[model samples]
Target: MNSANGSAWDDWDDEVDLLVFGAGAAGMTAALIAHHEGLNVLVCEKTAAVGGITSTSGGTTWVPGTQLSVDAGVPDSVDDARRFLQSVVGARGGDAAREAFLQSGPLAIDELQRISDVKFVAAAAHPDYVTGPGAAFGGRALAPLPFDARVLGKDFARVRPPRKEFMGLGGMMVNRNDLGALLSPFASVGNLKRTLEVVGRYCVDRLSYPRGTQLVMGNALAARLYYSLRKRDVPVRFDAPLVELIREQGRVTGAVAGSADGSRRRIRARLGVVLATGGLTRHPVLRKQLFPVAAQPLSLSPDTHTGDGIASALAAAARLEDGGDSPGLWMPCSIRRAPDGNDHVWPHIILDRAKPGLIAVNSRGERFVNESNSYHDFVMGMLRDAGDGQSVPAHLIVDAAFIRDYGLGLLMPGRSRARIAEFERSGYLVKGDTLEQLASKLGVDAAGLARTVQAYNRDAAAGKDPAFNRGASPMSRFNGDPAQKPNPCIRPLGDGPYYAVTVWPADLACSAGLSGTANGEVLDANGAVIPGLFACGNDLASIFRGTYPGPGTTLGPAIVFGWRIAKFVAGKLDQAPAGERSRATACANQPS
Candidate 1:
């Protein structure tokens, strides 16, 4: 979206109090908040569906000191979260946005629930990704409560589906909590009961729905926000991408949107236009300039993201900023040809990596990082090792026992036996009758692979990881199998007939974007706010300066800033303090 040609537009085809450039969590949330304040809002979605990449995410929100935490009786305070952020990200450029996020997170949550259909439940045992001063073992991260997609009736189809690889049983979206029950239905009566109910519901749902109607994780969050908008009758134009920002005498006041019929319409926002168009992940030019060339950056964001909002903002005098520790939040994604013959990318975020009996190896077949660490951290390790470009396309070496016990990516436990040949044929799963054969097939140094495995096995037996401390962190242990050993994250390589999956660093979202303020105002290069121009979601530079602190880091800030943008436009940005903020300030004010 460029403003050079947009300046010629004269009359408006449509008008609203607020115009949102995306239909993702950030944009939808902003529209919802603005609609609640009696502002007429319209959302333009680039794709046919409502959710962006977030619909495929884990749907966690790491906002501290909410009623959900108190209701769950989870011990947490905002001050602790603040200190945790400070430890992980010291003196970042977006400190104002960070403090604003901390102060307004709980308040935003409260305001959202009071006015919209959004709901969250405190996670009982979610740990922060990094351990630092005042780090939370739990309580800070909350998950979206599972949403019954049937509420939307036919409109449910508009909610984007999760990645094909992430789903089970032909589009059944089984969440983490119910996975064990589904995997081992007869193991216990409770398991059997839940499995039966779940499967039975899916069977009935398939009669009319393309997928199961019970949605969880990011899908649920997206659906909830979408339903809130629908309830308010807010108009959302699908397949409409922002073409350009309409600046009236230096302030962004509207946008030109493109329709599927190849028509363009100037939609004016009486209050302001909010840029929330995913991010620069798919932008042809910006991706190269910002991403590390050595790391071979890939993105999980939608194809339609393509820098529409950011480009439009830049054309309107909004400045883009970069130079963070990392250009984007990353995951080690395993790619394979799916049943539909499309290349499927599975983000190795939580499953199997931290489990026993798997070690990630570079081209030389040596471990370069802690396999049990967070996905973002793990990919950062990959970038560090691959800066010279020789260590990339790392393989996750696993024994047959590891597959049997904890299935590799896209392979459900016990299901690999039937699909192994197909996956192997597709070059997705590499199998070896012996370690040497596997190393040769994977083009890894056989001698190096042997030595690495030997050292890892010795360390596993002793329940220690002196090299990288794989299982030392609380978060690492949380991702591991607790039943296994003294170190839940470590186990020796089992009997041969090993397998390996190739992985590459993929960004889940861009860390850099248009410079913006705590009030959601996009700024010029001189640090002055561009009047009436606001950016949220990934359109704004990350508040943490590219440091991933915990689960829901992306969604938490997006949702909060969405609310802040709406409040600012409605002239109520400084409304009476939420009780949650007072508690947070009180905790921060108290002496050590």
Candidate 2:
């Protein structure tokens, strides 16, 4: 089966319906839908592994204005969700993208559940970014399947753990309150017991399941699809990156790829190619190109997301549409040095909303924007010039009392206290006994820092935070402890030995990508579709422009469009005239 040149002739034939480029969440989701729709599907992954960023992400897919809200007895309409998206995304997003997402999201979720191993839980407390005017309060985000990893067996080694694992507890069934309770030590006994039970059951599943069958979120989706395809003896060769798209007469006929052994082999796809390889997060060149000054050595995605699939598709004459432009971008991340001397990057920390008494500042020692705003707003403020047309790196300032009373954003209370203490001793965290002393140590202006704190404290004590308006929406529930009546997220700066950590606006990835239609069709620079090509996930222009409308926004649209592209292609194949016998045969094998 495998040639000495390292190329395996995998039943190569010109009679397949779908060719999926990446096995990430979106691609895998599409594969399941297409396969169940009676299409012959072939998925190729560049890495030795299958799951992409979804495996390493928080694993929560944010889909706003979904029917799940309706089924749950919450009143959320597609029309209302569309209005909110327009407000957040502005004119960049129009009727096409909005309509596509709303129309397909519920079906996507439902279909995945019926055919795959998905166990979704509605977000009980995570509100749409736009909550006040025509926004759902707590029904947009969907958690991943709560699966037992034992199902994966040997395959488990290939799956990447979520970069932020603490957030993935509660079997993908967690409500916002469940998540908050998980974060809080004083109020987590019940949640803790339940979490232990879930872990116990997961351990059992791993022990009893087949070596290649696992039930974790990304692994669950991947395993279920893998099992289905494997049942039919479909071949999956890993470490096989798409080298080129084989073309004939301006249509994609097949592809050539490089396998793990460094040999190239050609495979034919009679129908079409689906590129769901995800974004270029791990591609430093792309990162620096998109965000010149945000930070270096940055990436929230796993090292596997090198944008190879995107590049290969472009080379095959697939034009990428311009995606959401960068604005109000916020990384809101945590940084700690790895043992290898490189920094461990963590992005999109929602804890800023739960903890109130803290504020973020640039290197110039001044508040730049609302620390509690959406991640988009938070990062954009950091990217702004700190007056006088000079650039300023940012740092986060938190009081000792604040940390003790309310907790640091991601560093849970019990563990965070010790970690902060260690960081202080190690010089990563700066602390001093007095306001002026702390400012002096951190190389910031003592008088200005003190004045800022004084004004903030004065306003907070009066039950009014005019500077930033910390608590503005339901999303800010974790701003601070409810026990602190006045300014729950705000506290006076006098409790000496203050603290500061050099912070940067970390990004999940560049959300700005090639623009695409709702059906995941990439258009030319002139806005004309180049038939036989499609895109989804970060590789496609975001339907909500750049701003995250809610928790599952990225995953929601990616899966929807992936399905949409397959459905569209299938429909076309089914309608082809009978005279075109050879073409019809190819189309028949692809899927409909």
Candidate 3:
């Protein structure tokens, strides 16, 4: 084999049955499945860390019809799942990709749990993001069981930590179930015991490690997959990025990768190559092309995701899907500069908006959205109301009571007076002594804000919202604080020391990318499959198009298609001639 630059290269540097381009959930799943099928696998990651955005995510998978859900007494069927997707997606890209996802998602979850340490539990109370035609109040979303990161030994450092804003007590990770205990540590004896147990574990783990080892959410999911890979002795190379896709007769067979020192090597993959390099959210040019508006610098995804995989696939003549209504999944994020002068982003997933006593208002100090809706829908409201960027930075208004109970972005509840003073002094939170003062501080019309609050308080007293119907839907109430009576998402913004935070439109994941078939094979401009090449994760065009169906829609399809590609490659390798198999084995055994 000779290099493209005409350099003499008679032998390959490395070879494997399958070469995976990214180390996120999709690529790791593919590598693990391939290794289990008696095939040699290699994973190359562009960043210094292994997990992509998946490590920083919620780590929930919206896979229906799983044994976990069945055991939890949640009734879910494939037909129902299909109907749910169809109702949300609605003839966007046909039903083939959605059908593939529904059939393979449960099987992928079951097989991974059987073969590896990956375990999942059903989130029985989590509702679908929308209360559409086929929405399920329960039995869809599954989160990874909490994992002990100490099992990874020294390799734990390779797992990217969760977002700083998502962590608590310095660098300790907490799940949804743990938040209640921590919030009301002195509420009951059991609560106190649970809080002490969690804090004690974190305190002990922090003595020897930079962060706690009690991993949850996306970090747990990524660690589980990485642990399975290490157990199978799969080799993963960090700081190695794909430079080119090697092809033979228009079929992608291998890749050229570059090292940190600018050195290059050719690695032949006899079976196939999988692209799972997150998505195109961070690519400035691509973001401009795909997004409805010019994207902001802030994103919920890790900064390492720069659309390299999407670019490579496009250069190989892969087609990008542009028929979706929106090209990316959105979330409202608040940014605050740390002492180190770097911007820290806090994604508003489940914190302040849905809780009672908070409302989102535009520049005119007018309420624009039902703040209790999902993050995606909330941001869509922002975009729709954004007339020439007026709503780009929407204001979330809350009162002293709300801030004391629920807290605002980056501002935890039950803070001491000193801590509140620090946040206000640092300009992370804007506080005013009255509604008119708060409106002035937020640069909105004081009269408009006062009128809005007056009407809202009257409705809250009556237990109904005539405007926007804040708590009318199942999803709205699902995210709302159940402790609040009447409407969980509606309350009067009363008292002094009102606060406001500026939120910008940020994408959690892109809903559009390379077009691919149901089998995960990349498709060209004419919708023809590009043999020996496949994409999964955010690298592949989303099955739901631009619509968000549920909590784990992105990750669910990613895991399933990753599994699908591995199975497809294994079958292809089995049908290859003996000589080709021998060459692949010989090449795989060669030393770097």
Candidate 4:
């Protein structure tokens, strides 16, 4: 099945030393690093454009012990990162993988910066997700390349702008504080000035040289990597999606890719194939298999991440190993369909507990989970709710204050407000002139909700969150109103004209896939390695197991693993002993 085994390149064929399957952040980073190492590289993207969800995401890369932290005057240590990872992953965290990630992260950043015109700024305020036990308050997360999109020449037109719900350009990195500033209303002159400053910077970038500078975190990252690869004359093909991987004796040799224009091409890799084609949240069958929840779809990840690469690896693995227990999933997230028909996902429990006037309740109209806890815990509560036959449609309760303060329901200025009212009238949003009335409207016992609110206020007044033990981390502060003394996020919802937006538990892209060692070597279910095949990003099981350790942890691991794969292919790690080989009985044996 290995189409890449022989030199099938005819006169019209182009050849390169490396072939990268995705041009998103992870693939782009890997391609840039390899290209910087003086290796010829080719990046083929399924999308007509490069920069996958990374362009749409808050472009932050979390890495411990980096120059960004040191230079920014924030302090962090490797020990802190290790302790945090261990606490989050328990015994499942591997020392080699952790070490590889930490050690290679900064080096990867530096190497890429040296070869490309990329710039990075530190997100000093972006604290570790949990600063309580073994986590640091600073220096772990780094922002995306601080780029002025004016440099991309004609490539700028292809960039996606940052969604207004969050601040920062495609490449401009910001943390919770920045997010707060964006979400906050024009209540202060300082905020207005800050907003103007950001806008002015973009205006300047637009007027300076380029006619259309599509500047954002994603575009900036893409431009830097794409330009760097192009500078080395690396071949890039767009709308080309890999269909299958060819293997010989348990080693992948090449891939068969079909282009959007109905052209098929065979690309053979001499070194190896990197499977970064993303996870299966976008695949309906995979979503049903993985989530098993009826009628609910995930919304956090792009629609393109359907675990195609993972499926391919699983197929190859089935031929290599038998009865492999698919890795467990880290199930979190709450999603509502966007007005544009896409899922609008946020760490719901986190956002509600962090932001005021938002609380999640089960169909019985009672609060079930710790509203202020991490996303994983919140999703677990929803899962439990689903099992109980209780329509755990999470209801986001807010008022005019919330609407005036922050953009609601993913609708921004110039966007239609019809969806918000539609959901409300359709019973998805419960609104009333009083708290009890709103609760009554939503099918919850009015007294129960009222009691819950009273209890929450008492906790807020005491500056203590006894229910969820929130306020322990800085992340929750963004959810509260600073003017509210004691507990900022714990205000009572007894105000007049209360509103409730039903929140539904939605999936983010699946965080589980082909099991691989820390070295990124694709391993069978029996812990055996498949030579010349590697996977990273959403294509492999996350190092954090089922929990998101912090922001940028995903991208951090991607960069490290991508770098590790490149180096391993170049024979840089002699310590990486090839493991035993085993095949799967069928690709279907792997997890959904």
Candidate 5:
């Protein structure tokens, strides 16, 4: 039904050597690599801007065995990372694609550094989210260096700004170091100087740009990749969305794309068409089928990720990987309404959840999960806690000291207790003079909450969390307040006044996608390759089998597989033989 194998009709509006269907990190990286390898490339973005979900992410790419890891003194290797993934994901997919990712991840990063402006630095102490035989303390995760969007000049408009709630001072973007100075500008002379410089630059940028030109995190990663492609003159069409693939003579040829003004064009691809259109998270039918009913209508991914690429691939007879333990990567988010009538979903990601003096509880007012755990695990715990039919959203209970020290979801740290009045009025923040009062306001069991707090405070004072073991892992401690004594993630809530923000589970990215070969070719249901078609990014099934191994689990495989797809199309990649693929898959399926 998807392939058009009738009489050949070649009335193309435009043609290129490679047609990339998304402008996200994966698509941009693929387009850049292909252009450098002598292919004329075109990147089509569904939205009017670049940086699909990547612009709002942390932009950390997890690639092991790189020279940067060695230079940073992190003793990590590909073998260790493999073991880590195997333990977390089990025998899913037999890990054929995962093994390919391990072999090429470091090489992909090195090639990007050598051929493009894409730069990354290994974090010295960013521990893995879980501790085990293959886990390393650091070096496997690489953060993209901040970039100046001013370098793009007018082209800066093409880059999507981060989520509105994430920006400070209206539209000013702040890096981690710059934010520290901005928050405590009056604390020290150095902080004041840095704040002044940062603010001054942002003010100047606001005159010409809609947001601050100083980009960091995922925005920086997207900007750097976009700029590199711009330098190479690779044309990226804004507002052009792929409609369907053009198949002729038993091979996928090009596509029918829709334009901004609602016109469609028949475009041709000489070499190949790479499907990297985010994922199927927003697809109405697929989302209902893949996500939990509780997770409906609340996804952190871009709205453009409506499964267009995957749907088109399915029509082309591509098979999908079935039955992943976790169909989508998750985050615990607290939402707030903006003046523009849009809801702001603030992801509780390594911000305040792991700090001391904070606790998350269910409808019964009982702690169900370790508040200091990774966001994914925390959300998984939330879903598991719902087995008893509590219908109520999870509540994170904190106090005045917690707000001033670590802040709640959208609340900034070091803010005064008085600053919470506006939030309380908006119903985003709940307050009570006592634990009983707070329980009433939050619809929680009053006596159960009091008992939980009494026991929690006593244990916290002794620097332990026996109930849920909050700070027992390397990840929990790494993201916790290092200043806290004994156990950095443990602390008792003070007397009297209490506050809370409701937490809901949200999907950050979809892992279920089209099944493909290690060489990046789209495979049909019968295990036959679809000529001239390939997939990457969220469009390709996750190598981790929907398991969250660590930071950049999604982007790492996205870039590696995308690069390999381009190389394979260029006839420069060495495809794994049938026997080798079988043996590798079998071995990876063995017990950890």
Candidate 6:
């Protein structure tokens, strides 16, 4: 009954009740659930590090109707969430898949919190990215509560580090709340105390470690999952990539994986295989087919996500979802090459664009969108304004006052002089004594720049943006500094020393992938289930059908479906023969 590359069953290296691929949040969650169900399980990671892009992400999950939201006094229900999804997703995604995600999301969170070390808190102040029907001011998005990486002990080294550009003070990881204290240490006694405590801890950590051990966001989520796995005694093989899936009687039964040194091992899974690889954003051919704009050199996803899961599933007759409005979730990112000859990307998620005194302009120096919009919408504006690639590299213009309070791109706030000098030296930022000079340096039209700034300043002074309405939305105000007068998202670009940073369209996640059933079974071209094969995370086609509904949309569904697939596999394992169960358990106890 063995299939795939003609690998003989006699050469099988190991066996387990379930095999999970890609060791990100989704994969790890699946493994944890399988172990909880008393099934023998194994996890395979394609890269040296287990946390895929999730480790470097914001680590927020948009799971509505959760206990955390209720405990935080935020009103949310399944009906309201369904309405929200209907308004945003329309009819693109199947009703079954969407309904399953909505129903399973809160349950997944509740179960994980009850059974594992995972903890979540409601983001009460965060608003949905778009102000549409059924959108809530809060309660929909949940973020992982900050976790202490020291809990992992020496295993902390296995956790992937956050992007260098995202950290501060030589790799000290700061959360959103701590960032405010760090930015304004003199604001109050409480602020000063918080700053001292954080800095003191960071200084102590740096004495021995390359980066601070206080994990936040994606790293915190990954660390918690890894900790849970270790506690459950789950065996995870790093640098092991799936090469082929073995089919028995038209059902997936096992897989062959290759090590970094080209050594191969066959693993027999008695129940099923779960594909949770991040997604297809880094695949060259797939990118060409999926992306609307010219292929750019930047992607926010980890390099390990190259459609491995999608390719493997499709090869086994799995179907791919079609009719997504956009094939990817995008972010506006800036690139800077370091002395090490590598290009570093900084995603402008919430730092600069919405703040006062900053404007984004196309090549002609004309504003095309509300600059205070979400990162996803900002890139959509760029794509729309990109006529023949003219706006491919849009410029974000900010004045010296803005840079001092809220740094542009990789330049941190408050320390403008030294950081700006370093940025200019690296050619990552352009500076000018006047708007005209800045336009000249950026290759934008001088007259257009002057006219645009003049009109914007007049609007800022009047506290009204008649052109784009930058400060009109709740989402915009959430990301803005409320201490400023009239409008938080609008201010006049006063005198001189204007700065410009080049921004490119970068994908944050693949919005389209292998089509699967609600329980995670891969679907064939005719919509029949490909038995024993399942997918979650970016490996599964997005439930939103390409719309960025809110923060954590990518992660929420990933966790829900991973949980669902584990439950489904557990049911199948319960029905298997005693000999099969014993053999799987025997293999699981064997040393890797």
lDDT of each: 0.85, 0.62, 0.83, 0.62, 0.85, 0.84
Regarding lDDT, does 1 or 4 come out ahead?
A: 1
Question: 1-592, model 4: which lDDT tens digit per residue?
Answer: 6434334433224445567888776787777766666666777788766666666565667888777788889867777777777777677645566667876777777666666666677766766665546676667877765565555566665554443334444334344444445545375888777766665665566555433253445556666666666667767688788788877556676677878879777766666678777666576665666564632454556667776787778778622211012222323443455466654444433334466555566656667775655554566566666775574656656665665444344432222357556655544445688877887777777777777777776776677767776555676664456776666666555466766665555544345566776667788767677766777777766666666677666777877778776766554544443341123212212221
Best by lDDT: 1
lDDT of 5 by residue, 492-560 (tens): 999879999998888888888888888677888998778778899999888777678788888888888
Off by over 4 Å in 5: 1-6, 388-392, 575-592
Model 3 Cα lDDT, one tens digit per residue, 367-424: 8888888888889888887767767788988888887898888888878788888888
Off by over 4 Å in 6: 1-7, 572-592
- Model 4 TM-score, all chains together: 0.83
Better of 3 and 4 by lDDT: 3
lDDT of 1 by residue, 175-209 (tens): 89899999889889999999999989999999999
Candidate number that wins on lDDT, 2 or 3: 3
Clashing pairs in 3: none
Candidate 1 residues lying further than 4 Å off, grouped into runs, are: 1-10, 294-297, 575-592
Report the error of model 3 at residue 98, Å.
0.5
Lowest summed lDDT across 10 adjacent residues in model 4 is found at 319-328
List, residue by residue over 39-63, the lDDT tens digit for candidate 2: 7877888887767766655566766
lDDT computed for candidate 3? 0.83
